[model samples]
Target: MPYLLTGAQGQAGRRLLSYVVSLPLPNTDAQLLAAVLAIRAARGGVGNVTGTDLSTLRLEDARAAAAALRGLGWQIDGVLFDGDPTAAVAVTIPDLARETGHPLPVGEKLRSRVSGWVARTLTAKPVKKLPPAARLAGLFLAAHGTCDSAGQIPADLPEACRAALPDLLAKGFLAELSQDRYRLDEAVRHLSGVRPPTGGQATRPGAVPSSWPQFNADAWARWKSEATPALRRHVEAVEHCALCALPVDRVAQAFMVAPRPMVIAKATMGAYGKWKGLHPDRGSLAAEFTVAFRAEHGHGPSYYQLTSGLGWGLDRSLGAYVVTRLVKNEWLVTTGAVPWTLRPGPAAQAQGIALPKARTEAPGDVPAAV
Candidate 1:
């Protein structure tokens, strides 16, 4: 069973599979690869795939899969089977590249996220050794299933996948399988595509209470009304982010409360010393990721989000130390301990990498970008 993902974690996977199933491709190994490749190319229409990626799929006919994609006007530079295993081959999809009518109109983060989901789902424990059709079927079932209820199989599910249902049931991927309906096993429920019900007791266990005594809505409104235009825009961006959908009290409380001084443990500093040596380019990479993240999300990434999205694999304490070091070195900046205010600092700007507002504002007014 794959580790459980949050509602936000599964969203991009659901959208990616939904888009691929809507296309004209048949249910075969080729279509399975297309789902992976298409999401990778969603942002810019060109994705890189190595021969190792092709071999890992255990496709019955790698050449046939590549040929089928070529038939759809996709460009595969060279034969996938003959290429050097480690070399990345650029695959271009015309439809995804277009400015208008892009089949998958997603941001850079979402494209990376969905692509990762597809890879992980395909190689999940229950289905990794199964045939390509069975693996693909598992993806459909997992994406459509809900944590609390059974789901009807999507109408767009491939005919090949339908035949592979028994394999999934036998492998413990499905807890229930009736005609036209199925439910994911408890272990794999985290991969469910459906958003859980909201607006009652919060769906997430141990969620912050929806109502915070410290938060006064009227006071918040008054504060915003009196704020400068730039500050107001920044506040509203965090408060009403479509992707975050944070509770009003949560948003208000973050802004109202003063941030406590950070206390770095000696162990965390030790870890950072070792980690930094292994990642000399961490500063530049972190800066670049923030620029792309801010363009997609109206605000900057949170500490946990920044590390995880970049695949830095840092624990909480170590991550804090690394970010602190980056700030001290002027590679990243934050707005007076405000959450999600991280952006490029002087070091990044000197290297010609900066946020839009950073480029436009005077040096002293850089904080206004938040």
Candidate 2:
């Protein structure tokens, strides 16, 4: 059987040729006598390699090559070897000829039959809307037979083209399976004149045949090791509430998807309005509470009121812990000894907390207490 190399001028092709040549073969080895085919019409000093420079060689060209070989009284086999790891595809020569079932083209035909297929595909209605770059990328992937039936792009696609996957998927040009992997839909493939290899089997893309890369666990561990510290520091710095010196995880758990502000009725704003008007200047949770309490009851929130406002299911001890932090930070202070009425401190005022207008009535059929 003879071997055909499609990307003969490419790196993979060069590496494959070098590797094949490096193999120790005895002079009488029958396998070493098998032919190596190239498309360029020159031996280029390579004794075992022969080719034709038909860049647009199609199925008909293959037949013509077969016929020409027969005319020379030589036997030709259809086996073609593609060296690209991601695009290694096997084709049954007779099956390809039978499936395509077209007469061979003759002299003076400048464009090969495959070029016509590509032209028809590009002008097809479904692919006509694709941007030029995306269309080119999609067509290349399809033609290579690397993309799966589900439209998943090979993991090894160039990074720049990878970014276009979402748009391609959205427009029905590709389907994403996971990170950096996409497939072209069947319609797109059919319209683009791209066909799966004969017998419908292929080696896994991005892997050497019969072997896989190292375990993903190592990569995951490395990423986590690097990312954890940076994430912890950012969470601590960004969410360190003055009133609650809770741990980073705790704050994230409570507020990451926290619910919207509670809707309280307006009729309940009587008891809190009798105290002196106070405005909070800080932008912390404690300052927000102080401002809200002052607007509702003319004073900062007491421990119980603050605890209820938390709605975080913390017990009084935890609530007291928060209060202690606020007091230590000089954001809040007790104004009355009997009931322990809370009031904003200089720090809270300096943070720009301000009083809100008193509401006489509630909106949306609810009393505004908060």
Number of the top candidate by lDDT? 1
Worst 10 residues of 1 by lDDT: 200-209
Model 2 alpha-carbon miss at residue 14, Å? 16
Say which candidate scores most in TM-score.
Answer: 1
| Shift of residue 113 alpha carbon in model 2, Å | 2.5
Q: Which residue segments of model 2 deviate by more than 4 Å?
A: 1-111, 146-156, 191-370
lDDT of 2 by residue, 219-306 (tens): 5335435633433333343233222223333333322333344333343233223211221211144554555434323334456445
Error of 2 at 56 (Å): 19
Model 1 has a clash total of 0
In model 1, the clashing pairs are: none
lDDT of 1 at 11: 45
Q: Looking at candidate 1, what is the lDDT of residue 97?
A: 80
